[model samples]
Structure formats: structure tokens, C-alpha cells
Target: MSLDDKPDNTAKPHDRLAEALASDMAAVDALIAERMASENAPRIPEVTAHLVGAGGKRLRPMLTVAAARLCGYEGSLHHNLAAAVEFIHTATLLHDDVVDESKQRRGRPTANLLWDNKSSVLVGDYLFARSFQLMTDTDNLRVLSILSNASAVITEGEVLQLSAAEDLNTTEDTYYKVVRGKTAALFSAATEAGAVLAGAPEDQIAALHDYGESLGIAFQVVDDLLDYLSDAETMGKNVGDDFRERKLTLPLIKALAKADADARAFWTRTIDKGDQREGDLEHAMELLHATGALEETRAAALEWADRGRERLKVLPESELRQMLDDLADYVVARLR
Candidate 1:
């Protein structure tokens, strides 16, 4: 379904931004469709279309377009950049589902589940290749550099997460680094590359980069928090999937910090040891709340969101800027 399919009463800041950039988004969509097609390997488009056609918020691509428009760009090159951002995002999602052995994404069965791991991985590689081609179409080396660096960082972050997984001693510092790599890299690259394409002033570009980075960090923290607090109906995945998967997130990290002797054993059994039993999730939730980790995680999300909003003050005040600021607020407001 398209962004317009959402109810008017439910219109969020992202919906407002999508409406404002409908024409450019349409162009990006066209480019994406044209690039995803492959005659030699029909499964590339099949796998990609399965995920791309799913009702995602399409937030990353929209960010590229919005950043360009906010910087007074009148060219059509932003559409290519927007499409490139989306391809990179979609590629990552495809590979992530494979790595996580996920069954669902965006409220539907994952591409890997529908097809196979081999198809998902190869198709993701194809999309990455397509993204590079699109980025080079602008003939701007700086744009290429920004996007390429993001791709590398995203890969590094995933590997870092794998090493850090199930480790109770995982620090908040490492958590932030992982979040920046896995989530914020593409976000910052999207906005920064767009500004570079628009020939925006260096200061404005840096501000947009910081804004996107902060926004992405807040967005991921909220996501990790929601995995525990939200249910499958709202979150699409089973509640406490991260706990079951033995992943170390901010809430768990904070709780680990405050764990007493008894709590430490519980964490060791379920998180570090990965020997989760029935009712362990409920007890884990209790510990998280009792230790104030959930509240602390929520506070961190809000702080990052506020930092993102503050960064926007450097840019010219416009409807797009206000919507971007509100978007930052909205990411954390989901906790309410």
C-alpha cells in the first residue's frame, strides 16, 4: 500500500513529509522499479518487490528527498539519491532477516521465509550493486564516498553486534557504536548525501548529518525498547524477541549494570547463556522495570530525539525542517 493509504486521522510527521514530496517520491519509486528488474535473474526483482512493496514507512528515501528540498535544490538528481538510499536500506533488511532468521518484517513474512536464504543473500547483493550504480549516476564522487562509507559502517556494525551479542558486560558505549553502525549510518548518509547533491553550505550539511544521526540513534533505541514493551500486534514480531535471541540492548545493558546477585544469575541463564525457559520473559520484564532500566532507556531515546531537534535549528526554518524536528519527537513519542 502507498503512504496515502494510511488514514488521515493517523497522519504523522512522516506522512506529512511524504505528502509534501509526493512527486519526487514517485520519481524515486519509478527509478527503483526500473533498477530492480533483471532479465538474467528474475528472482532479484521478485525478492526485492516482495519486501519493497510491503507497506514500509519509506522513511529513509523520504529523508533524502526532504533534505534536498529543504536546501533549495531544484534539480532531479535527488530522486536518484533517494532511490539509492532506499536500495541500500532494502538490501540491509533482506540480509538482516537472513542473519536474524526472521520470519516476519513490516507485518508480513520475510523474503527469506518466503523464498530461501540463498535467494535473499544474492538478491541483497544485487541491490547493493544497483545502489552503487545509482549513486554514480550523479557523477559526484563525494556522494559516492558518503554512501559507500555508510554501507561499510552498516556491515561493520552488524559484525560488531554479533560479537557483542549475549554478553552481559556489554557497555552503553558499545551499544551506541552498534546503533550508529547498524542504524544511524544509513540515516546520516541519506541526509548528508542529499545536502551534498544540493550543494548546500558545509555547515548546513553538517547540521543535517548530525540531525539524521541523532534521529537514527533515537529511532533504534525506541525500536529496541519496543521489542520488550510492545506486543506482536503492534511490533509485528513476537514480544521480547531480542531477549529470546540473546541480544544485548540498552535496556538489558542498563539492567545488567544494576543486577544484584540473584538478578545476575537470572541474566546469566537467559541472556548470556541463552538457556531461556517459559516465563523467563515475564521475569525479565519485571527485572528491567525493578532496576529502572526501561525508564532509563526511554529517557535516552528522548535525549537523542531532543538532540536531533536542536541540530535542525542551524538549518533554514521551513515546513520540511519543522516536520523533520517533529519526526524526531515522534520516534520517541511511540513509547507513550
Candidate 2:
């Protein structure tokens, strides 16, 4: 089913935005399906269909379409760009599942698990190529440059994360670098490219870029926080997956920063050496709470959300603008 066909009577802010841009979203979805097809290789469409039909929120593409509309774009080229953005995000998910050995995604079996790692990785590569082809359809060099750079940054971020994983000494600065590269880069690119496509004013484009960057950071921080707080059902993925993977997310990093000697040893054994015993997750939760890491992480997300909202003030007033502001609040609302 198309994204608009989903019955969401009690829709959240992003859902409401999706409804507002229903026509554009429909066009984007159609383009996505058209581009994902490959007559020569049936496996390509099979793998792409499984993940694309998995019911993601499509937030990144929505941001791209919304930004273009907010900037008074009248052409349909934004549809292609939005589809490209979604393809990039889906490709990342497919690859990330393989890299993390993830079994589940979006509350369903992951592509890697349902098929195989080779299928997932190759399909991801195909999607990346498709995304670039879509970008070129616009014939806009600036948009191509922005998205290409984002793809590069995303790869760098993933590599940096691999290096930082299981290292308790990974500093907040390094963490921010990873977040900016992997998460915020695409977000900023999506908004900036939309504005560039619309030929919006330089100041307005800059403002939207800043807004996306902050919103992306807030979104990632909240996702990390939910990893420690929410259950498997609520979060889709397993809770404490980051802990099990030894990824140094913000909450754990904050806890480690404030760790006493005993806490340090516990982190070293479980995270550094991968010597997790029974009840280690419970103990880790206790340390996170004792150090006020969860609370602090929540506060940081709130701050970034506020920063995103503040950046929107520079843009002209409109329904899309209000929804964008609300979208920022909605991202971190789960924490409340």
C-alpha cells in the first residue's frame, strides 16, 4: 500500500505532515517503485520490495519534500529527489542490518536474516546506484554534490563507529562526529538539496540545513536513549542492542564518563572484553540511572530539538513550517 493509504486517524505530527503532502508523497512512492524495478534481475526487485514494503515512517523523504514545498517549489522534480532520499535511507538500513548482524528491523525480520548477507549488501549497493541515477535526473549539479557528499560522510561515520565500538574511552567529541556523519549528514543534505532545487534564498537554505542537522542529532540521541529504556516491542529492535553490540552511544558514554571504580570495571568487562554475565544488562541499567545518564541524554535531545525549532523561525510562516517545528518536538516526545 502507498504511505497515504495507511489508516492513521490519530496521526502524530509527521503523520499529519505526510497527509498534508499526500499527493507529493504518492508521487514519490510511485517513483520509488518504478526505480526499484529491474527486469533483468528479479532478485533485485524481490529484495527491494521486502524492505520497502516494511512500513518505515519515511521521515527523511518527507523532510525533503516538505522543505521543497516550504520554499515554494512548484515542479515535480522534488518527487524524484524525495524518492532518492528514501532509497538512500533504505540502502543504509539494509547495510546496517548486515554490519550489526541485526535479526530484526522495523519490528520485522531484517533483509539479511530473511534472505542472506550477500543479497542484503548487493541490494543495498544497487539502491545506492539507483539513488545517484535519480539525483542525476534533476540535472542539478548542486543537488548531486550535496547528496554525494552525504553518502561519503555516511560511510565515514559507519567506519568511525566501528572503530569506536567497544572502546569505553570514546569521547563525546568522537561520538558527535559519528552522529553528524552517519545520521545528520543525510538529514542536512535532504533539506539543503530541496531548498537548492527550489532555488530558495541562501539564508533560508542555511536555516533549513541547520534545522535538519539539529533534528537529526536529536532523533539519533532519542533512539539511543530508547535502546536502554523501551522494550523490544516498543522499540522494534531489541532493547540494549547497543550494549550487546558494545556500541558507545551517548547514554552509555555519559555513564562511563561518570563511572566509579566498580562501574568502570563492569563496563570494561561487559563492553570492552565482551564478557557479559547474566544480569549484566540489569546492572548496566542501574549504572546508567545512578550516573543520571538517561536523564542527561534526554535533556540533550530536548536541547537539540529546541535548536531545530529555533532555526525554523528564520523561514516564512506556513503550515509546513509549523509542522516542521512540531516534527522536531514529536521526535523527542517519546522521552517525555
Candidate 3:
């Protein structure tokens, strides 16, 4: 199924935006298809098509289009800009699956698993190059700079995540740093680039950037929470994947912060030592509850969602703005 075909509540905030932006989204899709094509290397398009065809909300690109429209832009360049944002996002996903050794993505086998790691990496590189080309086509220096810096920050975040992996000493501050670099940077850049493309005022651009940042952070936190609480059908991957992977997500970090001696030992054996076994995941969940980490994490997500909503106040009061306002709550609605 395509992004629009994914079964979801039509009344949901994102769905509303999707319906409103249908024409623009189609144009963006056409741009994506045109740019991802390769006559020299067939494998580049093949691997890219595999993942791009897989269902996703296309939320990052949508944010770009939405930002531009909200800024009163009536031009077609936002389509190229949105497509560039998607290429950046898709490139990261391809690289991430390899780094995580993930077998599944968007409820299907990952590009790496279906083909090979080398193909995935090289194709991802091709996509990155394509994204740069798309950005350059806009001829907006500020937009180009914002997107390029976001790409660098994303890479830096992934490296930081690798360095911090399995270390029980990872703090909440480090967790935010990782989230901002790996996830929020693209989100903020997507919106900021759109606003820049539309020649939006500086204050409005800053507000959109802040809104995207908070929304992205909240989205990541909730995703981590769902790794423990959601089913495979809901999450597209098995529950407790992060626990099995020994990744120090927000919930785990919060749990570790309040760990007692025995709890610390359990974490050490299961996480630090990478000696996870059956029942360990369940015990980890129990510890999360015992430490109130899950609750704390939930509250944090809500707070970020609220912050994102607040940032939208600076934008004009329109249907798109209301959808964005509602989207902040909708992002965390699953927790409810």
C-alpha cells in the first residue's frame, strides 16, 4: 500500500493534512520517482524503490510541503524540496537498518536483507547524492545550508549513538543530544528549509523550526516507548527490539537512573554484557514499571508534544495550523 493507502483514522490530524495536501503530495511523489531513477546503475533504483514503495506516512516531506503552504507559497519548488527531504530520510533509513542489523522495516524485509549490505549502503549514498542535487536545484542558499547541516548532524548523531551504546552511564542529556541529531535535525531542517524557500519572516521560520524539533523529539520518545509496549503488528517489528538490541533508549536510561544494586546487576548482565536471554525482556519491563520509568517517559513525551503545540501559536490561524496543533497531540495519542 502507498502512504495514502495505509489504513488509519481519516479524521486523524495527519490524515487531514494529507487530504488537504493531496495534489502537492502527488507532485512530490512524481519528483521522487523522477530523481531516484538511474540509467547507469540499475541496482540504485531497485534498492531505493524497495524501501520507498514500502508504506510510510511520508511525514518529513509532508512537513516541508505544509510549512511552505502555510507560509503562503504558491510555487512548485516545494515539491522538489519535499522530495529532497524524503531522500535524506530514506537514505538514513537504509543506513540505519544496516547499522541496527534490522531484518524488517515498514512491515517488510529490509533492503539489506533482501539484497545485501553493500547494495543498501551504496544505494543510500546514491540517494544522499540525489538529495543534494535536488536541494541545489532550488537555488536557495539558505535552504541548501539548512539541509546540508542537518545531514551532517544526523551522521554525527548516529556515531554518538554507537559510542553510547550499552553504556549504563548514558544520561538523559546525552539521550536528548542523540534524538536532536539523529531525528529532530531533519525535522527542523525540513520545516526551516520550507519556510526559507517561501521567504517567510525570521520569527515564523524559528517558530516552525522549534515546532518540528519538539515534535520530532516527542515522536522518537514515543517510538521507544512503543518498542516495549506495542505489538509487532502495531510496531512493524517485534516488541522489546530495543531491549534485545541493548540500545539505551529513554525508558531504559530512566530505569537505570533509579536502579538499585540488584537492578543494576540485572541491567549489567542483560545490557552491558549483551547476555540477554528469554524472560529478560519481561524483567526489563517490570523494572521500567518498578522505577516508574515508563510513566516518566510518557510524561516527557506529553510535555514535548505540548511544547510543539505551543510553538505553532506564532503561525497564522488556519486549517493547516490547527492540524499541526492537533498533530502534536495525535503523535502522542497512541500512549493514551
Candidate 4:
């Protein structure tokens, strides 16, 4: 389930960055769970922690930590903020898996698959509440505003996606709208909040925010591309899962536009009606290739990643700055 078989280019850079930023020695992990855990509700606490304990990239929270330090944040409260960001991300995954009826995530059984959907939903709610509490503890009005606004945007994005499902008319604009809501909003919040916590200058904070938004969009574009390119072992899920679920992600949407009458009719039948068979995946892959849909999508990701790198120039030269640039490149490089 390794996302990359190319020896993980990010490992050395990530380790170096971690050593440099250097959060609390033992307390960050503890604080992550402690902050996510619910009180006066034993079941909720344990269940919420179970999902938080589930392994992930920890990318969003790490951005928060990095932003805080790059901005010269000297306070310990940034860790709490990082934990809150992680909880929000984990909660979204729990809800997303349920909504998608997905059984696997990050190379393992999804929470909804291992447990019941009921537990997954309830635990997700508990985590969201806990995340809000953690944010409230930060006592920074701007921090609360950032996370809260992002949460609202995320929900709106999900709702739009739900409506867009099985609709063949989904456009590239629609795809960008979905990515902005479902992916970029949180990334922007995580990084922007970090800068805010550090009390960085307005221009610097805005640069990080833009950097995160572009990087997030790039990350999602690669994800959509991988849905067609990779198998379950590499991608952590079956190829064409989004197609089987009738999700109107970028790959499918782009293919729809380029489809000829015959191909368009096929799309209507399979994508719009959810009538698919074993060969359907292969056929759709062919359409994606012949129509140049995959390449078009990959180009969009590359453009965003490049813009993200450009945004990093706003930061002063340092090891942290270089790592952030590399991180942006990594998000979109999976396509290559």
C-alpha cells in the first residue's frame, strides 16, 4: 500500500524537517490523543482515539507546526492547534469513507468497514466536537475563524458533490469547485492558522495560505489520476472505485466532454446509470487515454504544484523553506 515504490523521496527531507522543527519531545503524540478524546463519555473517548490512532500522512498538522516555527512562534499552544487540525482531518476521512461506502483507506480497512457505519458516524461527530473544543482552547479569534470557515466550506463542497454524483454534465469548473471545498479549504486553513499562531506578517501568512490551497488541489488531482493509473495495492483501493461509485471526479468529467456520440452514450449508461461490468473499468480507462483526459488532468495538477512552489519564494531562505518547496513538488509528482 505504499503510495510510491520509488524509495519514498520525501523520507529524508521529511526526517530532516522534523528534526529541525522539533515539536514537544514526548507530548505531541499524547496531546494528539488527549485533545481528541471526549470527556464524561467513555465510549466516545475510546472510539474517537481509535480513528485518530489510525495511521495517516499527518500532513496537515505538520504544516501547522512548520508554519508556526517559520514564523518564530515561541509558545507551546501551537501543538494543541496542530492536534485540532489533525482531528478535523481524521473526522472528515471517517465521514468521507461512509459517504463513499468505501471499505479501505491508507492500505487498511476503513473505520466504517471494521466497525459499523453507525459507530463511524458517531465517532466522527465526537471528533468534530472535540476538535472544536481544542480550537476554543487556543483562545485565538483568528484561529477559530479560520478552522470554522474551512469546515463550512468543506460541508458545502460535500453537499455539492453529492448532488453532482451520477451527473454526466459535470464540468471542469465543477471539478475545481469540488476540490476547493473537499481538499483545498482544509489545507489552506491548516497552514494559514499556523502562520496566524506565529503572528507572522500579513503578507507571509497570505503566501502560506495560497501555497496550501494550490498544493491541496494538486494533491487531489494526482489522486484522481491515480484512480485510473494504479491498482489497489499501490493506491490503497481498487482502480475505478470512483467510477463504480459514480463519482464525477476530474478524470471522469474530462472524459465525458471529449467523448464522441458512441462514447458519450456509453458514459451516460455506465456513469450516469451506474450500470457497469468487469470490462467497464478497462473501457473507461481506454476512453480516458484516447481522449487525453488523464494527461489533461495531470497537467492541471502540475500547474498547481508549480504555483505552490512559486508561492514558497515569499518565505525567507532556510532549510524549512526548502522542505516546504519539496513537499509541494511531492504532492503532484506522483503522476510522473
Q: How many backbone clashes does candidate 2 have?
A: 0
lDDT of each: 0.91, 0.92, 0.92, 0.82
Report the Cα RMSD per candidate.
2.9, 2.8, 3.2, 4.2
Score candidate 1 by TM-score against the native.
0.96
In candidate 4, which residue pairs get closer than 3 Å at backbone N, Cα or C atoms, i.e. clash? none
List the candidates' TM-scores in order.
0.96, 0.95, 0.96, 0.92
Model 2 TM-score relative to the real fold? 0.95
CA deviation > 4 Å runs, candidate 1: 1-10
Using lDDT as the yardstick, the better of models 1 and 3 is 3
Per-residue lDDT of 1-336 in model 4, one digit per residue for the tens?
111223334476555555555544234567876666556767766656566556565778888888887787878878888888888888898899899888777766787887789888988887788788888888899999999999999988898999988999888898889899999999999999999988999999999999999989999989988988888888777888788888898888888888899999889889888788778888988999999999999898899999988998898886677888888877776776
When 1 and 4 are scored with TM-score, the better candidate is: 1
Error of 2 at 287 (Å): 1.3
lDDT of 1 by residue, 1-336 (tens): 132333343578878788778888889999999999999988788888898899588899999998988888898989999989999999999999999998988878998899999999999999999999999998899999999999999999999999999888889999999999999999999999999999999999999999999999999999999998998888777889899989999999999999999999999999878898989999999999999999999999999999999999999887678889989989998875
* Candidate 2 local lDDT, 44-130, one digit each (tens): 999999988987988999999999989989999999999999999999999999998888877789989989999999999999999
Q: For residues 1-336, what per-residue lDDT tens digits would candidate 3 score against the true structure? A: 122343344588888788878889999999999999999999888898898898589999999999998898888999999999999999999999999888988878999999999998999999999999999999999999999999999999999999999999999999999999999999999998999999999999999999999999999999999898999877777889898888999999999999999999999999999998888988998999999999999999999999999989999897788778888999999997
- Poorest 10 consecutive residues by lDDT, candidate 2: 1-10
- Model 3 misplacement above 4 A: 1-10
Candidate 2, after superposition: displacement of residue 221 in Å? Answer: 0.2
Best-first order by lDDT: 2, 3, 1, 4
